[model samples]
Target: MQGSLSEDRRAQGEASAGLIRGELEKVREEGGSGAYGVFGEQRIAAALKRLGCGKEHGVYIGNGFYSVHTGVVCVSGYVTKDELTSEVHGAYAEPQPGTGPCVENRGGH
Candidate 1:
């Protein structure tokens, strides 16, 4: 069961990469004539990478950066339920969408 979960995560990551790439392409196709801050695609990539999605997952940009958790929340702050679910579903088989708490490791020696 654990192995299946891992595989599912990997697959999810790959799918996420595909969806993100498509969205980016759409944005590019639309063409912009102004400066831009980090946006949804960037944020999504950051979050997915932080969640253990690797480069092979296709979430990394040419600059070799992934979506940090903060980036995710920033881009998705205005997401609707249907949109959020659709986007998240592209990755995980389960709707476990969230940047779970991050705990620091302390030495216990």
Candidate 2:
């Protein structure tokens, strides 16, 4: 069961990252928020949650979904921690000023 869960989490992470990369690319090309609206933040948060570990990750996922009403987006596996951190930080920066630059701790326990 533990192994399966780990696999599931890994798959979820990959899927989330993929969606995020595609959306981000489109956002870059279009030079705007695209269809995500305020919810774009949620999508990003979801992707991070899939990869991260902790109760804080759950909080982030909840806020992210609430924030990104558009749809679930993913981050690609190729994305480095730095890139992911920057993207997540940028998404929630303005609306979540109290959150600060949200970076993935990686060593979630």
Candidate 3:
């Protein structure tokens, strides 16, 4: 059972990697500013979940810029559990002032 689970996780990771690669290809083909929006982020998060990455896994969307044009937009983040936790915690610790409340609190008041 353990071996099977490991194999499943591996397969999921591979599939996720492929999906991410496809997104990257699209961004490249569209000249970087292709507008991945939340689509790529959701894909990465789903892939991580499938691979049993847990909340400690961080999924980052990175964009590069060049002269008068956007460069490649890709996943420049790591898949390590520790790094993921750090990334998430760091983001939470930072204050986004002037953003006008959190998304969850928008409709409360």
Candidate 4:
């Protein structure tokens, strides 16, 4: 077993961010639709649900995933997926537009 999981809210957000980053990275490397495809709320939502974060975070997937429980955002940023590198960063409390340069409002309730 992996010792113990972090109960820290920030750490949990990072975990979710990491998953998204990984996906963006793959698409970036492949040089495909990741710029837009990764932004799809449905896909990201499914992935988040599989990660079992929804319950603990009071999560609902729309753009990325935000914590209704803590009022903390777990995912944010955009994916360039072009010749440029994709961007992924920490969550912001004030809801952001998922369609633009942000990721659940992103999925916020």
What is each predicted model's overall lDDT from 0 to 1?
Answer: 0.33, 0.33, 0.30, 0.43
Whichever of 1 and 2 has more TM-score, that candidate is 2
Whichever of 1 and 4 has more TM-score, that candidate is: 4
* Cα-based TM-score, every candidate: 0.30, 0.31, 0.30, 0.38
Best by TM-score: 4
Give a tens-digit lDDT track for model 4, residues 9-109. 56765655676566545544654344344444445444446555454554434433333232343354444433323222333445345322233343536
Candidate No. with top lDDT: 4
Q: Backbone collision count in every prediction? A: 5, 12, 0, 1
lDDT per residue (tens digit) for residues 1-109 in model 3: 0112245554554455454444444433443223432233444444444544333333333232100000111122332212221110112222223221111112222
User: TM-score order of candidates, best first?
Assistant: 4, 2, 3, 1
Write one digit per residue (lDDT tens) for candidate 1, span 1-109.
0112255555654565455445444444444313333334454454455545544432333222233122122111212112222222222222122322111112233
Q: Rate residue 30 of model 2 by lDDT.
A: 41
- Comparing 2 and 4 by lDDT, which wins? 4
Q: Cα miss at 58, model 3 (Å)? A: 3.7
What's the lDDT of the predicted structure labeled candidate 2?
0.33
